[model samples]
Target: MSDHTIPHIGAAWREVVADLFEMTKPKVVLVMLITVWVGMALTPIGAIPWLAVIAGNIGIAALAGAGAAFNHILDEHIDQKMARTHKRPVATGRISRRAGLSFAGFLSVFGFSVLMIFTNALTAWLTLFSMVGYALVYTAYLKRATPQNIVIGGLAGAMPPLLGWTAITGHVMGLPLLLVLIIFAWTPPHFWALAIHRRDDYARAKIPMMPVTHGIAFTRIQVWLYSWLLLSVSMLPVALGALGGIYALSALLLGARFLQWSYWLLYEKKPDAPWGMFKYSISYLMILFIMMLVDHFTWSWLVSIIFPNI
Candidate 1:
């Protein structure tokens, strides 16, 4: 081959390699990491250990990616039925099952080692369980067995924040559980919105998503109801004295907007679109976590400056 042809071939191979990496669903892993980071940030002013934070986030992200890869492998048949996922590397045969599972095993082992070495053993073990919960219990079983799949399976997805908190504190506590609860409440609406758009695909796959099992009307009502529940849960931080005015104000506004949009989704004769809500749900969670960080830092500073004697 000519020199120019060699370069072109190299670029093509690199693109294929990139496509393989996409199988791990890195963007979803990043969202999980963001929550973990925020959870670490929420530790009382002097409690955070930066080294553990870094190690824990990296390890958790790797395991989360491994779990996602397992999901891709297990859902391959159903994945092929959905237009959105039909081209996945595993589904398209660009990645073989043995290769995919091997990659997942490698990631899981490496992630576990890092967490055990750099963070506490508690964090390492909990994160390992989360990976199994998401990949085996949620993806392989609950997802196919129930229309309430996302609702029940969401526990695995909601665990990163708690893992993050424990990484820092080396123990479990109420605040971390509250964060888990907030994410748990947010999961159904976040996912069901997309499920609405893909109802036909799910029906064809026999996956029993909410829209497939309960019909769109019922699913929309559930979304609206869950949005309200999420809003109520968002305020618990303020009520419990865990967060401050900044988080309170931000949560109220974000949750209200979420509730309003969900109401429109429920009652509108023909709603504008549900995809935007799906997209916004991702943004909403990230922003909510940011507000928590902002609240903690700013409020802690304010309290110190305003009432030095206290």
Candidate 2:
């Protein structure tokens, strides 16, 4: 082959590999895995099946990543138009549509098989649902159809804790439901803050994000409203005795900070303000979940120390 053809083939191979890796949406999967692990750790049951947990988490992460990959495939056209997404493998012509789809399919199959073989059928089924929700319903329909898309699509994102909870217990309960509710409520504010910052990019892509379709002022109001709702939802675990005072205090403090940031976004019309809130929202969720995990272990250790007889 000529030198020019050699370079083209080498670049094609590199792009194919990168596209395959990107199918996993590794960063998002990492956070999801952490939250799921927290759920597994916090469950009142003793002696979780370590291998099962690991396998299940890997499967969940793969499913999430594959779903995101498929999203990129489906959204490549719009992605090409959006400044933030134009350089993605699919959008940039680094990977072909067929290649992206095949990689996504492979990951999805592998993930589902792992969950089915190593974990319960329910978890596998739920994971499949989440994959389809994100890849098909959310990406193909909700993303451009309506501003309320995230609200509806957030259910899939909120399922991780429950997936983890059920991975161990094989059933859902009030406590795990509370985790789901917290994430569900948190999603709008968490995403809208970013959407506000990326509104122009979204508009340029002809995507109807809330900030693009309904105006930034309206989106700001929704962000603040959802922030308050998330704060209230975060308190449920403590109220229901699923968590102790330490968790309660931490949740309250974090919730306050989250609300403060939302309030800042609501009032601050400057372009940069939403970006700050957007970044904080990511940190807020991760920290809040970490605090919950910490509080769980701390309270259990204190109880053991104080009440040795029990």
Candidate 3:
């Protein structure tokens, strides 16, 4: 090949590779991984196994990526119709359906295998179930079916914490469920804020997002309500004694800010309010989980320092 032709081919190959990576929705996968790590960290397993934790995290990331890829494939038509998603790899035909499917299949197999080998069968199966729940049940059916799609579909997305817990302990029980509940309660407000901002995009796609189906005014109220619900649910860890004062304080402060943003979204006339709330919600969850990890490690020391008599 000519030198110029070789350079052109190399650049084209790089673009394709980048597009493939984009189809995996790396940002979402990253957030999920953080929750997974926090879940594993909070588990009371003595003499933690760093190697298995690393491997388990890899497996969960792979599974989450595969689910995202499947979503890209399934939502191509809907994506092409929406302005924000019109340039997506599958939507724009930069990645073909066969290639996307093959990539997803490879990830699913690799992730499940990794979990089974390094974690345990329970974690592996639960991860697979979550993948299918998102890729098939949520993306394919629930998304197009109703205005309450996110509320219902949030379960699968909220499983990462529980998956993390099971990865280390090989069991699913109380604390993990509370962790899952926090994310579950947080999901509706988090997603609905974005849905409100992208109301027109979902309208154009003919997807029945809350703002499109229930109207933006009604959706804003729901966001406000769910924000309150999230605040309450987030405090449950402290109440149940799964977490302590540090995490409790973090949740209260973070949740108060989240509630304030949602209130602004509800009452304000500014177009940017919804997007602003959406961004804050992401930070809220991240910081909340990090605080959980911090409190998990430092609670006893902090309590001793503060309440020496007790």
Candidates 1 and 2 compared: the better one by TM-score is 1
User: Any runs in candidate 3 off by more than 4 Å, and if so which?
Assistant: 300-310
Question: Model 2, range 87-162, lDDT digits (tens) per residue?
Answer: 8888887788898888889889999998888988888999899889989999999998999999999999988998
Error of 3 at 73 (Å): 0.5
RMSD to native, candidate 3: 2.3
Q: In model 2, how large is the Cα lDDT of residue 272?
A: 78
Backbone clash total for model 1 is: 0
Per-residue lDDT of 298 in model 1:
93
Ranking by TM-score: 3, 1, 2
Answer with 1 or 3, whichever has the higher TM-score. 3
- Ranked by TM-score, the better of candidates 2 and 3 is 3
Please state the error at residue 240 of candidate 3 in Å. Answer: 0.9
- Every candidate's lDDT: 0.89, 0.86, 0.92
Candidates 1 and 3, the one with greater lDDT? 3
TM-score of predicted structure 3: 0.95
Query: Residue-wise lDDT of candidate 3 within 1-310, one digit each (tens)?
Result: 8889999999999998899899889998999999999989888777989877988999999999999999999999999988888999999999999999999999999999999999899999999999999999999999999888888999999999999999999999898899899999999999999999999999989889989988988989999999999999999989988888889999999999998998899997566999999999999999999999889879766777899987
